[model samples]
Target: MSRRTRRHITPLITAAGAAGAVLLSATAATAHVRVIGDVIPGKPATLQFRVPSELAEATTVRITVEVPKDLMVTSVPKLDGWNQETLPGAGGKGTRLVWTAEQGHEIQPAQSETFRANVGPIPDRYSLTFNTEQTYSNGTAVAWNQPRTGAEEPEFPAPVLVVDPEAGPPPGSAGGAQQPGTSASAPAPSVDAATPQPAAAEDSDSDSSLPLVALIGAGAAVAAALAAAVLRRRGARDGSHL
Candidate 1:
């Protein structure tokens, strides 16, 4: 192709490549087992975990989520098609929750499942990370237990729950009830673990918006590249006629 044609096409190609890279990164980040909501520093809260099957050829058959030793878990919801087991912690706290799927209940590729536990009088901490292990139908196991200590995120980072002190008062502290919520009719057996807690809160409003900002910037780059290509073609046609 001519030099002029190359100029128009090159920018378009670069823009598309950048956009694809951004989108792929975002998708990969969301594929891991993740905790869905925040918790108050010292109150009762239900934690929800979303686990997705990332293997292209295998179905997810089992998952195990760890609980911090300091956290008190009151109950686990009974899920259909899965059997739940809780590992006991010191003082009757739960350290881990395991769920095994029954026949025909495995999470298929590209599908996800959610698990929940009612917990708290949450320890005074900035966040909690649940190191999880996922087992696939093909006998492969993936451990999502890495911790985030710097600017770069680790491969297979563990699920994290943001602990916001401003979220509310601790149970019996103020507006909230004086005691922790009662346990479910059938609470899971508790276990103890020595999971380290973060020193301070790292999640913020700005951090949450970073992904959206990157996406918008990528879309703008693509749009600009497309517009430039059209303008170049129009100019070429005008010159030919002249």
Candidate 2:
């Protein structure tokens, strides 16, 4: 191509490539298992994990989450299609939670499920991380244990929860007793994901509006991603002519 034509086409190609990258990144991110909802530092909170089955042909059959030893998980509410098991930690608190799908209750490809547990009084911290292992029916296991440390996110980042100190009552406040913060002097016991105790009635009413808001936001993202792809294609065609 001529120099003038090449100059015009180069930026178009670059812009197109940038748009395509954003589209792909947004598409891939929806598959990550993520923690949802705010967690107060000093109160019992209902924490939820949204697990999405990423395989096209296989179903997700088992999920195990590593609970930090410093945090205490109280109970897990029963999910309709899964059975819950807990490994006890110090003082009868749960350290690891395992959820296995019942026969024919596996999370099929392109589907997702949510698991909830009562955890707290949360330790005083800025954030918490939960490493998760996902087992597929086809015998493949994917671990979402990689920590995100930089600007770019890890391919399979472990789910993380940010502690909201301002929202909840102060630590050791009445009706909201605080747990001791993680200490360097006293080593914490080795523990995996927090598991639940007895099955308790889940409060569906709390945070009820979040799902609708998330759905709307996700729809907008998908639309933007599609537009990005279209722009990339148009840029490619225009560049080819140049």
How many angstroms is residue 233 displaced in model 2 relative to the true structure, after the best TM-score fit?
Answer: 94
The list of candidate 1 runs beyond 4 A from truth reads: 1-30, 89-94, 165-242
Give each model a TM-score: 0.55, 0.55
Candidate 1 global CA lDDT score = 0.71
The number of residue pairs in model 2 that clash at the backbone is 7
Q: Per-residue alpha-carbon lDDT of model 1 for 52-107, expressed as tens digits?
A: 87766667787888898888778999999998988864376658788889999998
RMSD values for the candidates in order, in angstroms, are 32.3, 36.3
Show how many residue pairs clash in every candidate, following the order shown.
Answer: 11, 7
What TM-score does candidate 2 get on C-alpha atoms? Answer: 0.55
Give all candidates' CA lDDT scores. Answer: 0.71, 0.71
